[model samples]
Target: MEEKSGSLVEWLAPLAFILCAGWLTWHLPAFTLSWFPPKDPSQYDKLSALFARIDVTDSMTGLFGGYADAVDWAALLLLPVFGIIGVRTVRRAPMEFESWKPLDRLAVFIGRLTMMLIVLLCSVMIYEVILRYVFEAPTLWANELSLWLAGFVFLCAGLYAMQQRSHIRIFLLYDMMPRWLQRVCDIISTTLIVTFAFFLVYGGYGEAFDKFYRWETFGTVFDPPIPATLKPMVLLVMVLVAFQAIVNLISDWNAEPVIHTAADDIDQDELDRLRAAVGADGTGDLDVTRGSIQSNTPGKS
Candidate 1:
């Protein structure tokens, strides 16, 4: 699953890149407008004269011209596609563990929390719409509020997906392997995913730092410096997720007695005891009748 984790990091790297790009656009919205703006503009030059030749009329044309709004919304739509791809990948695997550890439980709890938050966000939006259309008393905060909640949803749910292990896979050969071969394959997969996640966090640190320094904010009414706030959280969650993956991988690899599904339901300890009583390979002078209980006396072995 480390490879899957790596894939997710790769998928999300673009979003981080776009965030940095938004910062650039925020600083130089007009620079992007010209096919090639003059490298040097005089202090006295009018802003209009700079773009005088271009006939761009959209709201995003002018300096600070709502480009952030457009990009942010576009990203909001694009992100979920990658997320969906990551999720479907993991759902294809069979259930691995019979019981989960503490971190696994925590991940499930976080998932539930995020689900509730989404529901709450939807309810708020519905109420806002009713207020606007029915009574013509629209609130300015609703839209911004939705955006804020959306940031949380995006971040928290991504972590939840990691815990759920529903990321992508190239399992063309995995299904064909023997049980021991499959275990080895799982070990390799887990190692790769952890490695990838480590590098993702390492590489993203600089971009996240730059965003934080700028105190980056959404342009609209919410006007929160959410990029700065949320970027670090994403990195942190990735690290935590990587740690959880490693833990789960280790547990799976080093589990005691190697439980198997096709084996009978009898306790291994009891089976071993019966085997000892019956003699090595059951070939020596013991009763061969079926359904006969062997008598156990003190010091029989």
Candidate 2:
């Protein structure tokens, strides 16, 4: 019973987020134009007027107007189905990927989604090239679509990097610290990241909400919902990053001390292969010398 309940919750969480995303996408125009209608044109300040100009009024002409019509509801509804697949894929991912927990699984899912976007981006660019050069015709949608996909790719990549523990850090001093001290440093770093994420979500909430409410566009000929969607996405991704940070901190709190050394950094397998290659000539083998050097290197071992 407990196992089944746990599985249900795992499915439910991503479903909730997907539903919320779809709801916001569907109602963004209504919320922006009707719920928080812009003030009178004469009373509008410079910024207000600029924003007002981009607001969607007609639901039958512009991007927002054709959003429901152009969009395939069946395909839109598949987002959660994709999320389910992502979660399952992560759960079964290689051990090196370290996707055991919910947070790690979520990050993997996002990373997989990013990979799909990259492929889509490449395909779009190729199609654009064919149209522009081969057929002597150009497209307005390709560039905007590529940009849109790239933005999400970048955002998802950040989350994936956090999960993989691949982000840059000056760990020179950190590797020298005692185990307890390392834990302390880890706590502090995670705390700072969480605080930053909090501020990002808090400060940007109104802006994101407003942009979505107004159905803000890019003001180009093929104007897209770049501003409206991206604003909210920034906050949403930040929240995920923050959650990953906390998960990492908790998971690694009891881990063994990671003391770095010159030898620790060296790839022994590669060095052995090199030694074998050198010895193939029947000349002096460097394995003994290399072993001595590694033994003398400064480290706990």
Candidate 3:
């Protein structure tokens, strides 16, 4: 029963995100209009008129420009899916060369999501091109949506880099250090990361909250709440990165040092597989040729 439940959750998580993503893509135009509906007679004064007309404090018909905001609903729906996946990931033991922690899993998921957004970004750009050149009708939302998704992609990529241990490090002198010294270096590096994350969250909290509370919009025709959403997201992901660094440091503290030499660099298993595939005898070509040469030499009867 437990196993079945776990499997169900695993299956449901990605399905939920996929369905929500598709729904958002389908209704993107409607959501964009909700934030910035068409106005009559005055282009510049439209936002002012919108604010005057819709009471920002009203919960049912206001905040986020009212119930017409389909984007918010899509986001809300995805929250639980992500939450389930995150919990499951964190509960699992760490894998070799892969952190099975919630932070790593979340970063990976966000990375994949960023890829999906790239598809959406390309689609929007292509659509905009066809509209502009072929139909001579350009959209105001396409560029802004692309920019929004690109920002998220870059942010998510930072987290993914941390998870993969692919971020820049000066390993020249560090590689030569003793294991104890290496562990000390790891501690110091992780401490610095944690400190930076702490400060970011501490200093940026008020601004993030303010933007979110006001449901601040970009004032453009599309009127995305980029600042409100992205500021908090950046700080949150940085915190996750800091935690991952700490986790890595602890996990690797007792690990054996990996020394790389020319002989050790070659993958012998891969060579053996290649030799097997080519139907070579157990001995290599060089050895066989040398044996043949020795046998054919003049002296021996």
Candidate 4:
């Protein structure tokens, strides 16, 4: 029962989170921006834009007519609910966490979110393919939607990778260095990352804000705010990556140094499974080394 509940939560939570996020993206700002007077010559001039960027008046119509914004309220509710579930369900992945404390419930959640996004992206593409090829009724939204989801998948995965310490690193020289020197190298790398994030956020914040405020979009028939959403996300994800790097540095400060080699890429469990499948006969010639699998044509060395 517990496993089933966890599986369901993992599967549905991300979908709900994405839907709620999309709803909030459309409706939340409309209310929050109420302090400022409405502007003219807006992107909301287009019907597609209006749908993408729900106006204060438009949001209250239809099923949401009785409430301030039914969808928005629901979105607000579901976002935190799923997020809390994520936090609760997250487990310590010590292998990935390595020297760090693995206080990465948030990263685990986003990692699941990325998994969900990949599913959604594939669904969108498959939908597009079927509709276009079979039914001859393609959608204008599907391509842009895939692109939009792909953007978040990349960003979220980066943060998750940071938490896992799985991001690419050339440790050849660093592994040979003394502990103090390795610490210095870590500081330098972290500082560079922080510096880059700072400059990028500082410089691009204005543009991200402008795009978000205007609800700038791809201008296709679907007219998604890819520019608005992804621009801000780039800065947001960079900050997160930088923060995670700092956390890693702090947690691993007193830890012994780690060395990497091609052998690290091999999965013992996977080899076990493969050997089981191949049987004892073929296993005699099977060898795993330097991240490569070697075999003889059975009865040969």
Looking at model 1, residue 85 earns an lDDT score of: 36
In model 1, the runs with Cα more than 4 Å from the true position are 1-98, 168-172, 254-301
Residue 131, candidate 4: Cα error in Å is 1.1
Q: Residue 187 in model 1: shift from native, Å?
A: 2.7
Q: Against the true structure, whose TM-score is highest?
A: 4
- Mind giving the per-residue lDDT tens digits that candidate 2 earns over 144-261? 8788778888998999999888787777999888888888899899999999999989899999987765557777777767897888889999999999999998888787777666
**Across residues 68-157, which tens digit of lDDT does each residue of candidate 1 receive?**
344444544555554443333322123333325666655544454476568768988998999999989998778876877788778778
Candidate 3 stretches with Cα past 4 Å from truth are 1-15, 18-78, 85-96, 259-301
lDDT tens per residue, model 4, 15-112? 77778887777564554343332356454344234543445456364343332356566777788987776667655443445442444667767887
Whole-model lDDT values for every prediction: 0.57, 0.68, 0.63, 0.74
User: Predicted candidate 4: what Cα RMSD to the true structure?
Assistant: 5.4
Task: Give the TM-score comparing model 2 with the true structure, all chains together.
Answer: 0.68
lDDT of 3 by residue, 1-301 (tens): 0122224555456546755654443333334345644454363244344444443332434236543443456565675766567345422222214555555566666555565667767999999999999999999998877787777778877876777676877677887999999888899999999999999999999998666544456678877656756777788888888887887787677889866455544466656555654444544323322332134547753
RMSD of each: 17.5, 9.8, 9.0, 5.4
Pick the winner on TM-score between candidates 2 and 3. Answer: 2
Which 10 successive residues of model 4 have the least lDDT summed?
Answer: 59-68
**Colliding pairs, model 1:** 2-193, 3-193, 90-166, 90-167
Collision count for each candidate, in order: 4, 3, 0, 0
TM-score of each: 0.48, 0.68, 0.63, 0.80
